[model samples]
Target: MPETPPRARALETDTIRRLPKVLLHDHLDGGVRPGTVLELSHEQGYAALPAEDVDALSAWFAQAADSGSLARYLETFAHTVGVTQTAAALTRVARECVLDLAADGVVYAEVRYAPEQHLEGGLSLDEVVRAVNQGLREGEEEMTALAGPDRGQAAPAGPIRVRAILTAMRHAARSREIAELAVRHREAEVCGFDIAGAEDGFPPTRHLAAFEFLRQENSHFTIHAGEAFGLPSIWEAVQLCGAERLGHGIRIVDDITVDGRPVTDDLASAIARSRTEPEAFALGPLAGYVRDRRIALEMCPSSNVQTGAAPSIEKHAITLLTQLMFRVTLNTDNRLMSATSMSREAQLLVDRAGWTWTDLRRVTVNAMKSAFLPFDERLRIIEDVLKPAYDD
Candidate 1:
């Protein structure tokens, strides 16, 4: 029997989980707990769930999300959004979102959702934002309290801070309205803005008004691009609309071409090739600008595979981007739908792409620097929190 390739190596499954992580592109409604979904359906008198058993319900969602179509994958959210129509449901889900990420060792996260979707229960848009913010506040408090003495050192050091990103669905027409809402709450809990939905025909340009509004307000925003689509979509998102970061920008790999495969499959040298030579690789204008400009690619590995953006973890473009030294950040786009975490995404890279701990630390730092928070705050967390955790 032949020896397995180095790309086949995997760290201890728990090792990645112990590292402090940051999340940038998580969705609020899409990450509802399966058990909670069942309970919420019962509480809200919404009886449309396909499965009653907890494991079966989870399996059903995973299977539904496995469809290679982005539109089909998005359809799985109807049940989650259906039950989250009320303030109470929204609050509970947001609270759980914070606590769950804290337990997974995430120190910072920006969770996003569309306010327009939650208005089906007759709540005003302002009311929806306030409810979600209140839940985030309470969830942060709850996580701190739980970490007091019972969990001891198992708890993540320092408090887990969360901020909200107001998202407008691209297939809809209320982006300008949502941009105003985000600005209104900017000083409150809302940290930034975003536009999300299927990307085939509904380009980010459809929400240009919103992007311009945010830009004038001196606010930050991320656009969902280059996942189900290609480099053209990414170009529109970054060049035309001025996105600060790209959500699931895995397709940026389309802009990159290699002269020759690395003689060794290890990730370290692959990254060295990116920093050293132009002749060894070809970066199209779009990719070169994205790299040179420090525009972060919010790469979601497992979710990309689930959405058919990439065929498998082994073949995902993140490996190439990391090797090419592009500004890459790992994320779990929809924790429930993709059934992944930041740690799991990093671990998959280690197991399938031969990523090293240095690669993990670099990506984590890339995420911290690209965080939507103010510069001083991002610096504080990086210098005080992240460096200390990973430096050891």
Candidate 2:
């Protein structure tokens, strides 16, 4: 093998961690710190955790979720969601999530959680949203203060802004209610709505009422599609439900081909062939629609690998999607479960997939563009914060 070219070489770990990032698909219940889970479980008197000690519990979550089945990977959320059932627990988890992301150099994030999952503590859905919002606000203030007088331009760590995307479990029946809740709090830190769960049987069409309501009210939403399922799910999400973005849309590769042959199983070969002969690759109608419309694919490499959506970082469809300019954005779907952060995801692509600084910067810009934020705010962050920071 030949030595790697300098331009394509991976950036240093510390340098990657210091670069600013934007995250669009992160889960609140999926990212609770193990220590927080233990403490909260103790405080709430819930003892169903698989492990008692912090380290053991952390390892358990990572291991349990590493199973190469999406259904099995979702089982790890029980302990995390089990512990955070009250306002205080939810608030603490949300605040810590922001701080952790800030430390990992995520300047902007839209953290999501199913509101119905946290209501078992007897709190109403409204209260659940309020508790999480309170925590997000507190975290934002703390990050801002940490940035000090210069507003983080001169500091080692910069300020972070975290917004909420209210999620409704797709298997449940409260999607319309959750959509209404999200629209109600749209001005109070809640940025959007989503439906997430196993996507096999519970199709996006099942929640048609909720999507229709959101669109009628002029609210933004994304659908969890094309991860465990295939193109039909994505077709319904885009054509039927009007999803603003796709949550883990890696399976869209099922609709792509190279030289008239499907590239689902032989993605690495297809990618290599495309590099030498770009004209050999072709996108089917659904893929063309998604790409032409710039529907952002919130691709989480490690999480997708753990759930067997992709083989590995090097062979992940994200690299091919990025090469094809498919409006791809990097994300850490579950920080605790995947043992990953924004920086870690970027570093993996750089090291395993030979992505460069330009690649990282492009994805970051793509995320900001696809963000549910108002146009001016998105432009301000991209022009003022993201561009300046990446330029350095």
lDDT of each candidate versus the true structure: 0.85, 0.90
**TM of each candidate vs. truth:** 0.92, 0.95
Best candidate, TM-score: 2
Q: Which candidate is the best by lDDT?
A: 2
In the order shown, the candidates' Cα RMSDs to the true structure are 5.2, 3.6
How far off is residue 45 in model 2, in Å?
1.0
lDDT of 2 by residue, 1-392 (tens): 98554335448887788778999999999999899999998899998998899989889988999999999999899889998899999999999999999888888999999999987889999999999999999988998887867654433358898999999999999999999999999999799999999999999999999999999999999989999999999999999999889999998999999877888758889776655676678899999999999999999999999999999898999988888889999999999999888989998988888887888988999999999999999999999988875664
lDDT of 1 at 12: 58
Clashes of 2: 0
Per residue, candidate 1 scores C-alpha lDDT tens digits across 121-161 of 99999999999998999999987777655676545554698
Q: Which run of 10 residues does model 1 get worst, by summed lDDT? A: 262-271
Full-model lDDT, candidate 2: 0.90
